[model samples]
Target chain A: MTSIAIPRPAYAERPWILDWLMTVDHKKLGILYLYTTMFFFAVGGILALLVRTQLAVADNTFVNNDAYNQIFTMHASAMLFLFIIPVWAGFGNYIVPLQIGAADMAFPRINALSFWLIPPAGLLMFSGFLFGGAADAGWTAYSPLARGSGVGLDLWIISVIILGVSSTIGAANFMVTMFRMRAPGMTMFRMPIFCWTMLVTAVLQLLATPVLASALAMLYIDRNFGGSFFDPNGGGNAILWQNIFWFYSHPAVYIMILPGMGIISEVLPVFARKPLFGYKAFVFATMGIGGLGFSVWAHHMFTTGAVLKPWFGFMTFMIGVPTGVKMFNWLGTLWRGSITFEAPMLFALGFLSMFLIGGINGTFSAAVPVDFAIHDTYFVVAHIHYVLFGGAVFAVFAGLYYWFPKIWGRRLDERLARIHFALQFIGFNLAFFPMHLLGLDGMPRRIATYSESSGWETLNLISTIGAFLIGVAMIPFIINVVMAFLRPKDQPNDPWEANTLEWWTTSPPPVHNFDSLPEVHSERPLWDLRHGKTAH
Target chain B: MASHAVATQHKQGLSNGMLGFILFLASEVMFFGGLFAAYFIARADAREWPPEYLLTPEQVASGVKLEVEFWLPFIATILLVLSSVTIQFAVFSIQRGNRSGLIRWTFVSIVLGLVFLVMQVYDYSQLHFGVGDTIYGTTFYTMTGFHGLHVAGGVIFMGIILARSLAGQFTAANHEAVEACSFYWHFVDVVWIALFTTLYIIP
Candidate 1:
């Protein structure tokens, strides 16, 4: 057997700052994304703790109503926009090419541009807090309210528009790279499921984001120019805002979840020591989820009295079937396999169990009667946090642990990783599970304080306690990351004996991903390499 | 056998420039698709489109306005369509190593694109409507405003390609920039044609 020798290019002359600032390299840009998103995640987490503390005791006056509103509003907006979306984009920028056996993303300079646009947009959004207050109309920014609010709402609108531009450019780059820059033998079917989900996610982002931009622009015009796009007095309908907003937002929800789903699909197969059960079924389910996501936007408006209730109700229930099929496929993959409970595996398992509960509760909301009972309650908050925080955030951690070695060429400490996992898992459920009970007892979300006699004191206190524990769990994970970077330990290729093509390369792949692209024999090309049918 | 195999492999992959252009078009389609969906929903719910209170209420309220006046945009549309053709000729000339033909057609396309843009501005000025005055005014201006921006982008693209061509930077094999610019110009042309039919000729 012979190994191909790859020549390393000589270092070019450039300042360190200039090198990163003007970089078209996907790897460098990916690192930039990782750091930026992590910063925002911490900021969002602090806001979360503040909201919990205020709610811990009934009628507590730790913060005034205005400050309380800003905290919760900014918390939701920061976590959803600044953290989750960018984190997925960061991971995709780094790993998708490696998984597909390519050197870098297609349109590399545009990829850099997409990431650079985000920080400025984040600054615009958060700077509002320092000036007067951040947007307090919830992350949804449901018009009339947003329009009537002060300069903070105006800033929020501009920030979202800029972020939409960034997302669109990134989506365009991803589509091109996936379609054109694959390794020689990697066909659409042969590409990893994560890449496929990304392809679908990029398409959804490209299609759906612009509508939101237009809606925001219209709202801007209405607010500034005496236009009546959503003004009831000027012959515009408030219902119009709901329609335009959800047209993009329902798909935006999938944009948040699909990438996480992709991460799990990749993780589950590897840890199960089995080929993914029903590969084609998983692909169809992914497409089904993306397609159905658009039609169900009206489900969010069922309480608004604008959309046809029965029709939205039916479409909403239809979405549940594909989601159910996905759950079955995950369980089927684990059936009778030699499963290892590694950190990544543990997180993936947590995502599945928690996401299932979220899914069931989400279906409950689709039923008109149930939704009426829980419309603005903490129950809805619990349900969505389970999905987004438990489902998406857990999978994100799993991917980070799984790919950290591949990115840095060093192993993260296993002991510290397990401790991080246990604290996070325990703290997460305790924090969110009690919110459902409080919601049923008629506690609405986004309110600063509740009366002592409202019967919500005990539940609120427990939820707050759980939130602090989750914060403590984050410390070990941060330490483990820093230690891994300081100690440069060499690891063998295929450290996990993983089934994907990425594991076949060096721990940290070269600038160009591969010396010569391998011929893919199946979805699990590394499996074929291990069996001596293919060579590295 | 190995040499033959490598040649076959080389033939299979697309040029990066073409792939980038296709992706750009896909994103543009979604951009315009969103605007179109808004138009359809708003129009469907309207009791009297262009409204009885509009500035041109006499003409619109009587419901007897000639659709032919809308075809004035078709003139600008035709000029854009022809500009796309000229740009393609320019790219083809570059690919065939005909520098003179490339230079001449590139200049002609840019001139036509500028003329079309000027006429579009003129058309907007001539309209007896303002964006906030009526539902028709709002939708019409927003849709056309975005389309005009696309045309402006196409003109800028042409300008860049022209500058690079004059510098003698492109070659027979590596003129992907010229090729991509032409593709973009054609895309702008197609979008205008669709916009023309839907907004104007369809009534």
Candidate 2:
């Protein structure tokens, strides 16, 4: 394949700083999203270390109780809101237009607006620390308690509302771009799996994030405006907060993971040397997860006694079916194929194994009796981390490694990537696996200290060690990225032998993604180009 | 290249701008849906429509009624519905190449939107209690205040359209902004009707 030598203008000649701030370029904005979210990830990671350090031994007083609450609150806030959620947006921004063969997002200015909203919101959220103290109401911010917190809670509410607005607008942009901007020959069914997941994720975000905004607004009014929406003293039901919060948040859990599932689906097919096992089924399953996402919100509130436990348990258990279908589809794609364990594939495989545990453990909670045992315990904490960190974060790294060549026109060092993966996989299990046992043995979460006689010290210390190892794992990833940047952009456009429309263009695609796209005949247009068109 | 660009634009009935606006309105629906759910929950839990918990027994005995008067807000609702119609007319006029008609109707819609806001504020002044007075006052103000803000936003949007219309920016072939403005105006109008139903006529 003789690639066209398109003359690209030199970015070095211009002032890149000013260019970045004012630029509505989708690629640049995607890069900004990546860098900003990764920074928050580091902040969140440090706070995690603080949390682990506090709990590493019995009766530890590394920080006072109030400060401990703030630390964990911000940690989850930064990871969930600032990092994991927006990082998918980052990947989607960079890859979706390229995959769909569009030059830019449907609304590039709004895309920029979405990216710009994050930093200020992050600042406002964390700035709670400077204003007396930060929000300690946990991320769920269950009311009467949340209503009673300091002005910091108000800041958190306002910040989350702003972020919700950003996600809502961004989701709309993604939907419009996919709907309106697909290249001429690509039909909806023929679209790539990543795009499919994004489409589903966007729907979840658009409809669900606003409910969170509404929840936050009520919290704000209740706290400041003498409103008694959640104050039981004022004829307000305290349980109303949980109902509205989970109504948005359960769908939000899907919002966090669905795109990661998309990334995995993309990576798996390439590494296994096959087309995706069940393209249509995978699409249907994604929609199924999204449709069922709304019905299971009460599962989160089951122990509160306000929810219909049997109904919520039934719906929550039903969620696993679609999720199981997805799991089988991934495994089926890997079976009977010429597979290789490249960095991206390793992380993809890592996501598969760990997310399985996440899925299985979540079911234990779906059983109302078991949930009664572990509700608000370290076990539930373990369940979330396995899903978000093990599932979403692993896929995030997989995506970063997979797309590094295309986005930057360079490759991350492969050997260092393996080391990073090993440390993360081992460290993650060592960290969270013990928490399940600890919870079953009656160890509550979010506490700063524990008694030595409780038999929890060994596990807590082991978890702390694992947490540090996870922290150590970042060193190799950082080094690999630095090394990749120091080297020249020498990778080919099809470095990974990929099948998507994105790989059809230049390594760092030209300003307008493509000079001309090949006639897309199926989902794997590039594969069709390499090998003659399939019988389908 | 020009032909390729045109082909890529995807000429569907709904313009990308209009589609995006509707999706945004879909999210706005969920936002208001949440507030209404809270209102219903609050109402259900209370022994009375206006829970006497919020008022001092003396104030409650002073014959202060928590019931909302329907007349002024009904008039405001009618004005808002009329504005929705006028904005649609503005969009229709633009589609037929009548820029003057578009500008005139948009200006009238903006005027009606402003009149509705004025009436709402007047109604607020005539309220039997403050926002802090009771859960009834709280839900009433939060829901309607949010709708009022959306109306204000719609007016500003129309103001922009009116300016652009005066500048002759829109055409029969291309008036996505006008169309989007109308969709948003209609959304605000529908929300006001829901609010009027919930707060004024539900009892």
Candidate 3:
């Protein structure tokens, strides 16, 4: 028997900085995204802690009113634009090519460009804090308030537009890569659900992001050029701002969560030791969620009195059906299989449970009466944090654990990861769950302080403690990553015994992913490999 | 040395440039869609569509200016649309190993694209309302301005393909660059037709 030798190329000799600057390799860009997103995550996390601390004691003078506003506003902006979206794009860029058995993303140079735009956008946004007060209007930056603010708001607008450009370019690349670059046998139906969800997400980004860019440009014109796109006195309608903003912003929420859902979809099946329970249903549910996402933007405008309440209310409730179907599907995937409570699995479970609570709270807000009562309160804050942090961030962690081996070719410290998950789950709930009560008790959101007699002091303190616990939880996870990176270890090609085709490739796959493209005959090509069935 | 052979073992598939063009067009769709939606919503709610109060007496007196009189754009649009056909012919000719035919059509297509762009610039000069005049001006200018930018991009692409054809870089067996450029030129032509009908003929 003759054995064929596959030649390995020596690593290219280049200076470190120049290598990163010019390289089109997806993995390098992915690492760049990871480090950049983590940096922003830390900054945003600190801002979150500051907000929590100020709210910890009623009538507290931890920071002045203006400073508190800047802290919370930048926190939301940083977390949403700079951290969550970029991190997910980073992951998608790194993994989707491997998942589909492609050598590299279809447009590798554009992928590099997409990753490069993010840090500059983050800098432009955060630089405002040092120069003046950061944007005081919330991340949503509703018109009259955003318009009324100073140069900081202008900076926020510019930064968001830049980020939108980055997202749009990245999404365009993802869509093209998914459509044209799949391996010979990797049919669309046979592709991993993560890739499918990303495909949907890229479509949404391509279609929706430019609207936000246009809206922001209008806002800029109104702010600086004496245009009247939003100024009521200048024959402009403020509701126009809400309509246009939410048109993009509603789908923007999906942009944050759909990838997380994709992560959970990938994670649950592996832990359950089964093919995904409802593969087609899950795919349809993703599209359904994305499709219905556009119709419910008016729900965000319930307080504004310009929309038809009954119609918006009904559509908002309708959004729950597809979301609920996804919950059931995730649970069904875990129903009877030999379930393992690995760190990634645990985070997936946390995401499911916490997202349910967030979904239910969202439904409550859909009711016009309930929304009117809690419109500007801490309840909305709690609900959003539960959704964004508990749902999306948890799923992000799950993906990190699940794919860490594939990217780095080493196992992250399992013990440290589990410890990190426990602290985060507990601390996350402790921090955010009480805000619902404080909100129902009439503590309005975005306020810098409250009177000592407001009856919200103890809960606020507990939330602050939880915030610090989250900070502590992050320490071990960071240490684990550093340790794993410094002393690299080899992992088996299929570390998770997973069903997906991505597991078929070498860990830290070759620059061109496959030596020869593998033919994909089923959703679980790797499963077929294990079963002694030739997938090609 | 063996690594170079391994890298080239997989026959180079289509150029990534085609993917870039498709992606660019998808984003352009959203950009135009947003403007169209804004125009529709504004037109729907206004007591007087296009707000007669906002128009100048001369523009109003001219009985709606028959948006078609932006006829220079029509000429530009025709030129662009014909260029798409010529580019495709060039692509087909290349596929049949007809080198001279490919070069001839490629040069023709480039000339048509350049002419289209020149006409577009002339049309911009004749506009009665500037981008800052009113909402009508804003919508009109932004939509066509972006489309003009796309046309400009197509012209640059055509120029590149023309240069490559002249250099004998593309063979009959592998002309992905020609195919990709033709696809983009066709897309630009389609977008112009849609813009012309919606912005001019439909009203």
Cα lDDT listed for each candidate: 0.82, 0.91, 0.82
Identify the runs in model 1 with alpha carbons over 4 angstroms from their true place: A1-15, A516-519, A532-536, B1-14, B54-75, B88-97, B127-129, B169-174, B197-203
Model 3, A28: alpha-carbon shift in Å? 2.2
Write the residue-wise lDDT of candidate 2 on A22-92 in tens digits.
77778888889999999999999999999999999998999999999999999999999999999999999
> For each of the candidates, what fraction of the native contacts does it recover?
0.19, 0.71, 0.21
**Which sections of candidate 2 miss by over 4 Å?**
A1-14, B1-7, B58-65
> Candidate 3 at A367: error in angstroms?
2.7
As a whole number from 0 to 100, the lDDT of residue A364 in candidate 3 is: 99
lDDT at A81, model 2:
94
lDDT of 1 by residue, A137-217 (tens): 888888688778767778888998888888888988888788877776777888888888888889888888888888887
DockQ of 1: 0.26
- Candidate 3 has what TM-score? 0.88
DockQ, ranked from best to worst: 2, 1, 3
TM-score of chain B of each: 0.84, 0.91, 0.81
lDDT of 1 at A415: 89
- For residue B37, model 1's alpha carbon misses the true position, in angstroms, by 2.8
The TM-score each candidate achieves on chain A is: 0.97, 0.98, 0.97
